[model samples]
Target: MSNPESFRELCRNELHSGPTSGLLSGYVQANLLILPQSAAESFEDLCFRNPVACPLLCKTNDSPYRLENHDRYIKNGHFDIRRDFPKYNIYHGGELIEQKNNCVDEWAEGHVGFLIGCSFSFEYALAQAGLAPKNVVQGSNVSMFVTTKYLDTSGIFHRCPYVVSMRPYKVNDIEQVRQITRLFKKTHGEPIDWGFDGAQRLGIRDLKQPEYGDPIDIAENEIPVFWACGVTPQLAVATVGQSIDGAVVGHTPGHMLVLDTTQVS
Candidate 1:
């Protein structure tokens, strides 16, 4: 994980894989979404409207055949959105068609790839603050839950419920954790809620059965803290994919794209 290019190469060849939670420390990571040009405007608007849930980093150029992070932001120009992530979810006609290690063969004209800010980008700062990100410490992906709360609908995307990533912290350290995360606004910023029954309020009934990622044990003195997730867009499209033709593409839960940019503050 010392070299971003080497890690990406492992992904490209399907050699190294998993939730990139703690790997490649001191670099920014992103959630990815790819859609047709016809659906780009609405999705972009959706991101702007729900900044906490979908902070946008960059979008691919008009050439849909390939989507790369903006070169200016990356130290190396060899990353490919389609093949760099550990896993990808493909949708069609409102249904999840399949998951793949690489989707380079699927890219076509009119497709636009989006790079969204991920809470993973702030985990390093959290760790430096002595508040170990539970998932990283546990060697598991951060647990994600689709909540009952709904995001503001924009254009063709409608009724998308908010998706949240959870981490447990000792009650006394929760406030300091929130302050550290708030400074990383471009990377999810702050905890939406924390404490006992907080997840229940967000409509999560069982903490053990998270919709995505692996679950961690909540210690006796720790509280479950929540953050807005970039996966919100996928949930939105799944609910109304018929309107957009059901051709959305994104990274599978917990498997994010690691980038060279370290800090945006």
Candidate 2:
């Protein structure tokens, strides 16, 4: 489904359920994190401290099941946060307990929904620059890894490591890829590191074994490029020592909420 609205409808109806990468090519795709009001403030602060990993787009107001107030965040009036996502992970005391197609039953009053900008949002621009991500080309989910490097702690959210998404490119094309992705400030602006040495610097021991999403093959001359991923928030939710009282919810890795807005300016 090329159209975002219709595609969203399919998701809403539970007709579509899988990774959303390369599906809605030009539209902005967002990572969904729904936290109880008790944890919302601290999580927001965590995002503020780590903008590269969690570029927050907009948050819901009083409505727990719908995104409100932000015009650019929601283009469809009927967009339901509970049902729009392809899949949701329910975490209890930092452990994933259940996966659901729709989180309507899990979301409670006073819960706030945060939409984090996704790296997938910039893939169209990357393709335009002739630097399309390897996962997109191979019809697979982007490779994501939980790095040894930790993010700055914020309130109850601590001990969270940096989760990075990887894309492969030729050694010579790295500079051009950097130039193109830098324009997308809201969608994880630029590569944090590139090349094999770069991946080693981030403490990634193996490129093939990713914590989330499918691994893409790196060609002989191609090098793997790393970017801070929106999935960092999920890692934060899981690793935080202070257990959240209520259930913490997030979009399943590689499955994202497709937004109606165009590429971030």
Candidate 3:
């Protein structure tokens, strides 16, 4: 996990198929979304309005995937949106069509790719602070749920509710968790909410079940802390896709694209 190229090669060879929470520490891991040009503009606006849930890192057309800023693009090199990630969720007319190893075949004409900030960036920071994220410790995907909270709608993305990822921390360490996460605003920022009654506030009644990711144990002295998740956009795409005749593609929960940026370090 120390080498980016090696991790990519593992995914390239289909040897990996799980959430990438603690791997390749210090490098950025992005939540990837690919939309048709028709839906791209509106989705971009939605991200702008909901920065905590969908921080925009880079947006580019499919085919030649590169960051928009030319100088930075040169250093980051070219990434093929279709094959670089470990897993992808393919949607058609808003329905989840399939989960695939890669989306190289689905990058049809007019498709655009967006790279969004992910909480993984801050996991590295948390690790450095010795506040080990629960998912990393358990070797599981961060638990994610669709909440009653609504995202600002733009264009076809209508009535999309926010999705959140939760982690457990000792009650005493809650303040430290907030302070460490606050530094990575581009990556969902600080805890949106926390505590024994936290899930109820978001309309999630059962902690054992989540819309995405896996469940973990909550210690007696621990409380649940949440962050605006990148999964929020996928929930939006599902809701909006039913009404519109289009599709949205995204990385499967916990499976993300690793970047070369030292932004977290």
Candidate 4:
């Protein structure tokens, strides 16, 4: 087995750039969050309520930046959360902003850490179904968008809308797409809706102007399909709670936490 800490150091050393899609190969990459104790309980409840966006993979018992993964941390003497991740986004007073690679100094004992399953888990399932993602198709990041919809009331997070990712495919491939992704319920299960009409319902109108990822052409006989993206929560973290009254705190959209688990298991 490879030394996870060494890999982390290497990622930080030089190659720790760009999308990590094919880098880890089979690891269960995750969406991350570090919130104050006041909102942690509500956030967890929101995650449980809307399992699609917030899968609720794992959480730390105490201050976020200071996590004790025991085994992983022990195995690597240098298991510092701040510098470990290639990048991070900082959310303060509900506003978000990108931070340099390290944010450990900003950590307070009151913060809590959260990790959620990512759609990356189903990449194999997607490939197995013969419907490899187009983001992977065009060698770019996945396209994401914010929606007007909101999850049922839970707490501070209940007011946000579900974010979604769009992929164009032939009508013929739709069935295979469903059958394959349906099996990965722990991840983002079957498509919530299909075709361009559904895409519009999700607040993603421009196929060419994706918030992320390059636009892939839609075949004359095909339509754009939508999936309940895990990135939804991240987008919420990035866009929610921003008011024009001099309150614009937010986080970056694409950055996610990479988990210690691997999909190749």
Q: Which candidate gets the maximum TM-score versus the true structure? A: 2
Off by over 4 Å in 2: 65-68
Ranking by lDDT: 2, 1, 3, 4
Q: Tens digits of per-residue lDDT for model 2 on 123-189? A: 8888887777878778778889999888888989877899999999998998898888898888888
The TM-score of predicted model 2 comes to 0.92
lDDT by residue (tens digit), candidate 3, 144-257: 888998888788777899899989899899999999999897899998899868778888888778788898788888888888998888878878886645667899978888
Q: How well does candidate 1 match the true structure in TM-score terms?
A: 0.89
Model 1, CA-based lDDT:
0.82
TM-score of every candidate: 0.89, 0.92, 0.89, 0.81
Question: Of the candidates shown, which would achieve the greatest lDDT relative to the real structure?
Answer: 2
Q: Write the per-residue lDDT of candidate 4 for residues 120-215, one digit (tens) a residue.
A: 767666765667887676776776666666776576664677877777778998888888777666577777888877876776667777765566
lDDT of 2 at 149: 81
Full-model lDDT for every candidate: 0.82, 0.85, 0.81, 0.63
User: Would you list the clashing residue pairs of candidate 4?
Assistant: 26-263, 27-262, 95-249, 95-250, 96-249, 96-250, 96-251
Model 1: per-residue lDDT, tens digit, 33-57?
Answer: 8887778899999989988888888
Error of 3 at 57 (Å): 0.8
RMSD in angstroms, all models?
Answer: 2.4, 1.8, 2.4, 4.0
* Candidate 1 local Cα displacement, residue 10, angstroms: 3.2
The whole-model C-alpha lDDT of candidate 3 against the native structure comes to 0.81
Candidate 3 off by > 4 Å = 9-19, 61-63, 70-77
